[model samples]
Target: MKLQGKTAIITGAAKGIGAATARLFAFEGARLLLLDKDEANGAAVAASIAERGGKAVFRRCDVGCEADVRAALDTVVDVYGDLDIVVNNAGWQLNKSLLETTAEEFNAVLNTNLTSMFLFTKGAAELFIARKKGGAIVNVCSTFAVVGSPGYAAYHASKGGVASFTRAAAISLMPHNIRVNAVGPGTTDTPGLHDGARDTGDEDQGMKSFLALQPLGRFGKPEEIASVIAFLAGDEAGFVTGALWMADGGYTIV
Candidate 1:
């Protein structure tokens, strides 16, 4: 019960790492607000948690939109009475080279993958600072932030920006007892990865290549990444902040 009695908002909770985090947090006794653009999946995840005797509410939200971000935070306050943690797990990626990527595509990826962090932190902090309560923020980044990869120009830029933003936000919010950190995951077996594989025209080949890159000789599971997020959000991470944790199975080490 690491998060017992705490209220947490998990954006992108419809599936993948976000959904996994929601389940683990719920199991650890958190009151959850699951936010996602995928309304159906988000609701299903929340309902599944409820069916298991955990408390959760699903809200449809576009993390990149300022109004949506505000409304989601407002819902958290109105429904849960207080906010203890936020997992900014929403992200978008397009596997295209700079020459092939359109300006619109670049901006859209940046808005969803990077700017949403600014919005969530700013919006949620208003309530946290006002109520004089401390909180934790966990941003989902990617190993691409540190290691250069062919294609995905915008994705790389956005994730690199997230890592930098995490550090800056942590330093700025420290006085208020807000701990901001990031989790950089390697090639994980998420729906997004499958989608990326399809886009590249070979799911099996992509998986094999990805697995070969990992020192663990396998892909990461969503639950593995979520476990780290759970740890960072809990009381055990009280003394930790401004850190970028690699949950990538040593993918970056090689």
Candidate 2:
């Protein structure tokens, strides 16, 4: 169990990458507090883990809200005793060009996708420093951070910000023994991706277009991406920080 005895909080844990990551972490022996706005699914995730003999709790949260963020940290302390890892995987996507996106849409995307990471990192770092224990943070970014597309302008900007914020947080938190890193997934087949596809006006066409860009000819599995996040969070990656590990099916290389 790579994460045996660790306690973790994973945002967006109701679905997609966050959910996958939570399941994997629990399998690897981490007690979990799963946060998501989707209360039913989040609770189901926690219940499944508990059925498998893992310790897990579900808490509804809007990750971008400061009050919600603070309450989550408090819940971690009260429920799990202490925290060892933070996975900032909550995000919002807009499948629209700059011209098509509204001012409100852009701001909401930024708050959910970028600002949430900052709140968690700062809170986790402070807690880790206070407790005199090292911790790991894994942020979910996207290949769109480095590459560009005609649509998802706001999403691209948010993920690009995630990559930069991760690097800076890593450096700043290094002295306090908190490792901050990110994972960039490319064209993953998640509920979020499907939603983005629908937003493109045609799910079939949007998906085919995404698959065409994948050099591997298939999308990265949620489990595959989750494995990378588990590695970064565990002690096996003790020397790693300030890194953006791209699990993008060779999308960025070409």
Q: How high is the lDDT of residue 210 in model 1?
A: 62
Which 10 residues in a row give candidate 2 its minimum summed lDDT? 192-201
Task: Give all TM-scores, in the order shown.
Answer: 0.98, 0.98
Which residue runs of candidate 2 sit more than 4 Å off their true CA positions? none
Question: What is the C-alpha lDDT profile of model 2 across 73-108, one tens digit per residue?
Answer: 999999978999999999878878999999999989
Residue 115 local lDDT, model 2:
95
| Candidate 1 wrongly placed segments (more than 4 Å) | none
Model 2 vs truth, CA RMSD: 0.8
The window of 10 residues in a row where model 1 has the poorest summed lDDT is 205-214
Q: For each candidate in the order shown, give its overall lDDT on alpha carbons.
A: 0.93, 0.93
